[model samples]
Target: MRVSVILPAKNESEGLGRVLPLLRSVLPEAEIVVVDDGSTDDTAEVAAAAGARVLSSPYSMGNGAAIKRGARAANGELLVFMDADGQHNPADIPLLLARIEAGFDMVVGARGASGQASTGRGLANAFYNRLATWMTGHRVLDLTSGFRVVRADRFREFLHLLPNGFSYPTTSTMAFFRSAYPVAFVSVDVVKRIGNGSHIRPLRDGVRFLLIIFKIATLYSPLKLFAPAGLLFFLVGLGYYGFTYSTMGRFTNMSLLLLSASVIIFLIGLVSEQITALTYTRPDRP
Candidate 1:
C-alpha cells in the first residue's frame, strides 16, 4: 500500500532539516508532507529543499489542525503521523506500518517511561492510560503518543471528531476504541527534541489536560465515568437520609438535593451515551 508521512511543524526549521533527510532514507518511496504551521522560520523552505511536499498555513494553527490539514491533503492508503520536533525516530515508521499491514486499523508507537519528556508528563500519561483502560476494558499502553500509522480511510472517518488542539492523539485513540476498531501498540524510545523547547506550557495546558480526562470518558463511554459518580452521590444521599430519619425523624432538603443530583447525573449520562452512539454512525451507513 502507498504511504504518506506527515510532519506537523512550527518554527522547527532545525528539526525539519534533520528529520526530513532521515525520513527520506528510510521510506524513499513514501510521500512526505511537511505541514508548516505558520512558522516564522524557514521551515517550509527546509522541507522543500529536502524534496518534501510542503503545505503552509498563513497563521499558526495548532498541532492537531496541522494534522487534519495534512491528512486531507495526503493521497496515500496509509497515513503516518509523527512530530517534527526530532523526538520521534523516522526508523520506527516501518515498525508501525507492519502492524497496519497485519490487519490493524491503527498502530501507535508506545513510549516507555524513560521516553517521557519529564517526570510530570510521564505521570500524567500513566494516569490517562489507566483511565482509558478502565473505560474501554482494554489495556491502553499509550493514549497520547503522536507517532502512529493508520489506514487513511479509517483515520479520515474520525476527522470531524478530532480537536484542533494538542489532544488530538487522545481524542483519536479513544474514538478508535469506541468504534471497535482494531488498534495495536509497539514500544519505542524517543530522544530529546531539537531546536526550541516544547510548545506546550504546563500552566496554560493544565486545563486542557483536565478536559482530556472528560473527553476520554465522553468519547468512549460517558456512562463509565458518570455512573460511578452518580452512584457515589446516591450512596451519600441514602446515608444522609438514614441519619436524618434516625435522629431528626425528617427527610431534609440536603438529602433531597443529593438524591436529585444523582438522578440528574444518571439521566445526563444516558442522553450522552445516545449522542455518543450517533457520533460513530458512518455517513455511508443507512
Candidate 2:
C-alpha cells in the first residue's frame, strides 16, 4: 500500500526546514503533505520548496485542523502522521509501515525515555498513560505522542469526530478502541524540539489533556467511565431512602428525589453513548 506522510505546522518554519530533508530521505516513495495553519513565517514556502504539497489555512486552525486538512489532500492507502517540530524521527516511518502491513489498523509511535521530553512532562505523560490504559483496557504507554501510522479509510471515518485542537490523539485512540479496531504500539525515541520554545505548556496542556481523555471516555463507552459512578450514586440514594423509611415509617420526598436524580443521570449517560456512536457508526445506524 502506498504511504502518505502528513505534517502539521504553524509558525514552524525554522523547524520544518530541518525536518523535511530528513523526511524525504526516509520516505522517498511516499506522498508528503504539509498543512500550514496560518503561519506568519515562511513555513508554507519552505515546505513547498522541500517537495511537500502545501495546504495553507487562512487563519490559525490549530494542530488538529492542520492534520485534517493534510489528510483530505493525501492520496495513499496508509497515512503516517508526524509533528513538523522535529521531535519525531523520520526513520521510524518504515517500522510503523511494517507493523501496519501486519494488519493493525493503527501503529502508534510510543515514546521512550532515551530521547524523550522534559521531566515534568514525562511524569505527566506517564500518569496519562496509566489512566488511559485503565480506562480503555488497552495499554497506552504514550497517550499523546504525535507520531503514528493509520489505515487511511479507517481514519477518514472519524474525521468529523475530530476537534480542531491539540487533543486529537486522545480522541482518535478512544474512537478506534471503542469501535474494537485493532491497534499496536511501536517504541520510538522522542527527540527534544529543534526550536527555541515548545508550543505546549506542561501545566496547561496536561490538564486539558486529562480532560480530553475523560471526555473521550465518556463518549466512547459511557458505561466504562460513568456506570460505576452512577451505581455509587444510586446506592447512596437507595441507602438514604431505606434509612428514612425505616426510621419514620414513611417514604421521604428528599430520598425519592435523590434516587430519581441518580437514575436520570445514568439514563443521560446511556443516551450520550448512543449519540457518540452516531458520530462514526454506519449510515444505517439506529
Candidate 3:
C-alpha cells in the first residue's frame, strides 16, 4: 500500500532537524508531509531543508487543524500521523503499519507509564484510558497518544467530528469504535521531546479532557453516561421517599420532586440513545 507520513509541527525546528532524517532513513519510499502550524521560527525552512513537503498556516490554528490539513494533502492509501517534537519513535511506524496490514482499520501506538512527560499527565492519561475502555466495551491502552496509523479513506469519514484543538486523537479513536471499524493498539516506548516544553497546559487541557468523558458517551454509547446518572437519581429519590413516608406518614414535596426528576432524566437518556444510534447508521445501509 502507498503510505504517507504526516508530521504536525508548531515551532519544532530543532526536533524536526533530527527527526526528518531519521524518518527518511526508515521509510525512504514514503512521502513525508509536514504541516507547519503558523510557526514564527524556521520550522517551515527546517522541514523544506530536510526535503519534506511543507504546508504552512497563516496563523496558529491548532494541532488538530494541522492534522486535518496534512491529511487532506497526503497522497497515499495509508496515512501515518506522528509528533514532530521527537517524542514518538520513527522505528515504530513499521509496527503500526504491520498491524494495519493484518486487517486492522486503525492502529494506535500505546505509550507506557515512562512515556508520559510528567506524573500529572500520566495520571490524566490513565483516567482517559479507563474511561474509554468502559465507554467502548473494549480495552483502550492509550486514548491520548498522538502516534497512529490509519487507512486514509476511513480516517477522512469522520474528519468533520474532529476538533480544532488537541483532542483529535480521542475523538478519532472513539469515532472508529462507534462506527464498528476494526481498531488495534500496540505498545511502544516514547522518548522525551527534544525541543522546547510541551504546549499543553495542565489546568486548561485538564478541563478539556474532562469534557472528553461526556463526548465518549455521546459518540460511542450515550447510555453509558446517562444511564448511570439516571440510576443514581432514581435510587436517591427512592431512598428519600422511603424516609419521608416512614417519618411523616406522607410523601413530601421534596420526594415528589425527586421522583419526577428521576423519571425525566431516564426518559432523556432513552431519547439520547436513540439519536445516537441513528447517527451511526451508514448511509449505504438500508
Q: Estimate each model's TM-score.
A: 0.98, 0.89, 0.96
Q: What digit string (tens of lDDT, one per residue) describes model 2 on residues 129-162?
A: 7877887788987877789999999898788878
Off by over 4 Å in 1: none
- Which 10 residues in a row give candidate 3 its minimum summed lDDT? 277-286
Q: Rate the local accuracy (lDDT) of all candidates.
A: 0.94, 0.84, 0.91
Q: What is the lDDT of residue 143 in candidate 1?
A: 97
**Candidate topping TM-score:** 1
**Which pairs of residues collide in model 1?**
none
What is residue 10's positional error in candidate 2, in angstroms? 1.0
How high is the lDDT of residue 148 in model 2? 95
User: Comparing 1 and 3 by lDDT, which wins?
Assistant: 1
In angstroms, the error of model 3 at 54 is 1.1
Question: Which tens-of-lDDT digit does each residue in 1-286 have in candidate 1?
Answer: 9999999999999999899999999999999999999999999999999999999999998999999999999999999999998999999988998888889999999999999989999999999999999999999999999999998998899999888899999999988888889999999989999999999999999999999999999999998888889999999999999999999999999999999999999999999999999999977853
- Winner on TM-score (2 vs 3): 3
